[model samples]
Target: MTFQDYFPIWNKLQTDQQDRIRSNLNFRTVKKGTILHNGDMDCTGLLLVKAGQLRAYILSDEGREITIYRLFDRDLCLFSASCIMRSIQFEVTIQAEKDTDLWVIPAEVYQDIMETSAPVANYTNELMASRFSEVMWLMEQVMWKSLDKRVAAFLLEEASIEGSSVLKITHEAIANHLGTHREVITRMLRYFQSEGMVRLSRGMVRLLDEDRLRQLQD
Candidate 1:
């Protein structure tokens, strides 16, 4: 599929604008663990995911990492083009969670189009609002929810995303995502294991009781 297939306002753009975008678009295929965009210093352009998964995360001063959001097939990531949005001060890192195919529209070209096209500017604003809403929801979760509940919710969410009950992930990875220490996650997993909610193995955690986990999340 092409950028026209995923971009909602593509049909509204002028012929010349569309031609410029199509000509300048950069297609990339990255392996898992590849860092696509690092901090605010890099303007990596707007990424449109064609396949696989991408993760948007932030790192604390002491080196703790926490996921802000995730992107799947057909997802549009505007944060990668942070140079065009001067108001965004914090650094957000974009990485390939799995082997990914994507198309990137250059920030300068997109900004120029937005300057002339009201529809493009409006659409960009709407997208930014939606992303900010997701970030706000995450902040609420972090502030109001307990750690156990947060871990349970994260596991359920991960299972749904992967479409499996058995998760092939390490405690350290989970801690990194949740912005906590590895020992804390290990202890929580042990508690969950004792309660018969999960079974922990070498580098995996199997959900034995989804109902209980769901209850904890609620």
Candidate 2:
């Protein structure tokens, strides 16, 4: 798809502004596990996902990673250019969760356009607000939700996303996404298996009773 196709506000900008963006945008392909942005300071620019999956996460002082949000095809990522929003300072890291294709708009170029284009500025604010809401929701989950319910919700969500009950994901990976330890995930999985809600093997968890899982989540 063309840049215009992916960008919802393409027609909102003036022709010159559109030209500036088109000229400055770059196409990049990243392998799964590639780190696209490392920290708060690197102004890697805004990422527009063309295909595949991406993850946005933060690290604890002890060096454990926890996912904040995930991106799929046609998603726009503003945190990659967090420098543009001077007030907020978060040590967020973005990585390719699957082999992906993306469009990178230089931070300076996009910022410049935002200065003169009301639509661009408004669109940016909307994106930033949406991201902040996700972060807030995550904080609520981590603080108030039980791990078992969280795990069940995550499993059901993953199953929906992959369109399968057999999840080809490791315990450690689930821990990383949920911001817990591998041992915790393993213990929980074992508990679920014993209850017949799931059947766990080397690197997969098959849902035996999704209704039970959903009930637990509820």
**lDDT score, candidate 2, position 159:** 96
How much lDDT does candidate 2 score? 0.93
Q: Which ten residues in a row have the lowest lDDT in candidate 2?
A: 82-91
Q: Name model 1 segments beyond 4 Å from true.
A: none
Candidate 1: residue 9 lDDT (0-100): 94
What digit string (tens of lDDT, one per residue) describes model 2 on residues 65-91? 889999999899999998988987778
Writing each residue's lDDT as its tens digit, candidate 1 over 23-84 gives 99999999999999998999999999999999999999999999899999988999999999
Q: In angstroms, how far off is 215's CA in candidate 1?
A: 0.5
Candidate 2: the clashing residue pairs are none
- How high is the CA lDDT of each candidate model? 0.95, 0.93
